[model samples]
Target: MTATRTSSLRIAVAQLNPVVGDIAGNLAKARAARKEAAGQGADLVLFTELFIAGYPPEDLILKPAFVKACEEAVDALVADTADGGPAIAIGTPLKRSSGLHNGLVVADAGERLAERFKIDLPNYGEFDEKRVFQAGPEIQGPVGVRGVRIGFPICEDIWGDLGICETLAESGAEILLVPNGSPYYRGKVDIRQQVVVRQVVESGLPILYANQLGGQDELVFDGASFALQADRSLAFQAPQFEEGLFLTVWERNGEEWRCVEAPVGAIPQAEEADYSACMLGLRDYVDKNGFRDVVLGLSGGIDSAICAALAVDALGADRVRTLMMPYRYTSKDSLRDAEDCARALGIRHDTVAIAEPVEGFTEALSRLFAGTETGVTEENLQSRARGTILMAVSNKFGSMVVTTGNKSEMSVGYATLYGDMNGGFNPIKDLYKMQVYALSRWRNAHLPKGALGPLGEVIPRNIIDKAPSAELRPDQTDQDSLPPYPVLDDILECLVEGEMGVDEIVARGHDRELVHRIEHLLYIAEYKRRQAAPGVKITRKNFGRDRRYPITNRFRDRS
Candidate 1:
């Protein structure tokens, strides 16, 4: 019989972080994962979608040399299987006579068993696979690996209406193994489980889902890989926002297979998941880019304080630093608070007086200003001076600047570009002002599993209690210029995430005039958000690829 039967089979899930464009490094990671699986005596090791090419290769997939390099890496791995240890099921970009395809290859020993392409090329939001990849065949059969026939679907294949999973089941595939590069947003784990459960119920087969782990630019792939039985029961679940290697043992029960041995645990909460995504995103951005350390302005405000804490948690305290660029308007409370927060986190804190720089700029511009009254122009000079100082520090010490603006501020142009907005990355860029405060409280109450920072209140109580301020002028608070953060965040969410009209937002008990004004601000601030540093996306709609708006867009809801 051509079909194989097995009472038991073992498979390993390789949940790892891969840097885009790092072909050789990714190959090494694959090799190490395969070795680990072999040590565990597994039948096959499964990697995430586009593992060799490092997922979402974007325009890099358009390059022939890059695709060829990834193909060569897969060949090398196949050669390694010549010893007949365990099979390798990996994702890579495969070039065909028709076009390039997001391909998955299954190999055992020295022989290639199967090759399948993603039937659905996701072309919306964060995915643009259709821009580079061609769809797979209408019907795909399973490959027999160690007496078990497993059907593999790349990311987005099962999520669509292609009926690929059901097709595989009809083709006699006993189970499904899905490779995904799915990124994180709030409550994404539950969504994934629901999607997989539907597929399982439809196909009458179990599924093993392996998602990529780590930060790729603005996207953070939380590795909460897991398996589900045909009965809609969770077989096992991997941790989120982490790199893990998990082995699963499956046993044939009559006509179906079930995961007999694996991990089963609860995933992290939304708050923990958001915080972890930010930390992981910042860490990968800094390390993958080869930065020695990170530095951020600690203004004694909740935004900067939380960003500083996230930095310490991501990279140890010794690698993180903070600076306070104080001017005349800078209050003594801010001074003390910045110092206190730094001490609490045990990071380097320095003071750079921006008075002189501001004075010099004022002197140079006085003649040009002539009779112009001192106003926002002068206020912005203070911010610009501090920004210059931060960049200088970054240049001299080789530290990446951490921008500390929250989404609430970014939405309404509350942040100053090239000033407080100056940084290589922002950990909380996707978080709103209210969300930032919530995470601050959450961080103080809990030390994450692998956090490098100390336990207890990393952010001082005074910092969280005090009103937020940029201190560009005397007695300044965020509320003086814009609506309350709770009000602002809600309005922005309705506009940005919910895509609600002004009348719809006003119906949410907001002042009609205020909603219109905030809507206008959100549209006008597009230019600043366009230039903002890339940050981890925890929300469904981030400022970057997730939400694209024209900087010069003119449409606004006048109602």
Candidate 2:
């Protein structure tokens, strides 16, 4: 009997963030990734979905020049691969006879092998794929690589009860490789795991999943690339909140391919993951757009404190400045806490007491409002005063003002427009108030990536443990204007992201009146959110740009 030897294939997955419409730049990234894979003696290099043109180009993909430029870049990349190391598989848009397809083209050296188009175009919740892409009938077979058959499925193909994997398996594909440009949202990783496991169970083949990571305007992609073996075990894992590239080996055992288990790295906790994503998104937005520093008003509240810590961590201590704009109602404790936090972080701090401006504004408005007593009008005036000071500093010093309203406040009409709401960027606008506290504690416990300030206690402990207040009026507390954060955050999670109606949320054991009030507030805040600045998103549904609701609509939660 002659001894038989089976060949093994090593595939490298590149987790990268590419700028949209940057054709030449994306091609250079692909070339560099291929070179890295080749250096490791891997047989093939794989990139995320739409790697050539970047994901979700929206209307830009409809342009003829942009698509033509992408095609030319692909051609140049093919020419360069002639001297090659590893074969390449990358995603791009394909303009066909029927329509434009979100497609992937595979190549060996300089020759094109096979092309596959995504069959499922998701149009729900932050995805508008159906608006731009024409789906292709599933390609069942595999492309030959190193004399082996590998299956390809564009994102959304393996997501559900789709038979793409089964079809490929029946067509004699030994392994499945999925390329995705999935966006970030809370609990999305679990969703990915469930979908990938379904494909693995169906095809009985090991699968490699790669995803893009970065902030594209209002969206952020969390790169937690993973691999699953036929036995439903997670074989290899990549870190979240950053770009990475790694190789995994698959071995053949009898009929199916099995992933040789690589060490699984620890994934960040929910709070930590959310914090890092916010910091990275804000950092990139500032750096890429040529803003060097950030300035924010610190109210000794959870929102501004967390934003300050994140800004310092993202852009260094020298680039961050905190201003304590105290008024007559401003608590002494708040001033002391703000000073402590600034001193702890080693960032620039100043006290520009707003009492002078507050008095002047009240004196000016007294005659016009002679008949009316004070209410939210007076509260809003104080906020406007602080907003003016922050805006002036932003103008004169050229520092971007970082707003610090969390998602809870943003969802309701709790935030004052043209007041505390004015800023160039907000790091925590997507997080709930409860989440803000959790992340603040997490940062205090562990050092965040790219942190340049001192390691211990950046946020004052008193601030984290104290009640949140705007201090716009005497003895003001957030609880006075809205429900407690514990109840408010839960209601928001259901009403906004879950899309649950009043009765449905009430079924969750909350007071019906409170639920009704929250629903009304959420609906009314659409107008304010429309004018709000973009923020880092950590949830499935964030206000502004991503979730568009009508301000004049009369939909009510009758239940």
Worst 10 residues of 2 by lDDT: 1-10
RMSD of each: 1.0, 2.9
What does candidate 2's lDDT look like per residue over 1-559, in tens digits?
0124346778898899888877888898998888888888877888999888988798988888887888788777767667767788889988878678898888876877778888888887778888888888556588887777889988888985668898999898888899998888777888999999989888888889998988777778888899999898899898887686788888888887887845467777787778888888888778756787999998877788889999988889899999999888889999899888888888899989888887898899889999998898988888999999999999998899999898999899898999999999888989998889999998888887656656878888999988888887778788987988999999989988888878888888899988888888888888998888889878888886567899997787875
lDDT per model, in order?
0.91, 0.85
Residue-wise C-alpha lDDT for candidate 1, range 68-180, written one tens digit per residue: 99999999988898887889999999998857899998998777788888889988778888888888756578888887888998879889888889989999899899999
Clash tally for model 2: 0
Identify the runs in model 1 with alpha carbons over 4 angstroms from their true place: none
Q: What TM-score, computed on C-alpha atoms, does each candidate reach? A: 0.99, 0.94
- Highest TM-score among the candidates is held by which one? 1
Score candidate 2 by lDDT. Answer: 0.85
Question: Could you tell me how far off, in angstroms, the CA of residue 544 lies in candidate 2 after the best superposition?
Answer: 3.7
Would you give me the overall lDDT of model 1? 0.91
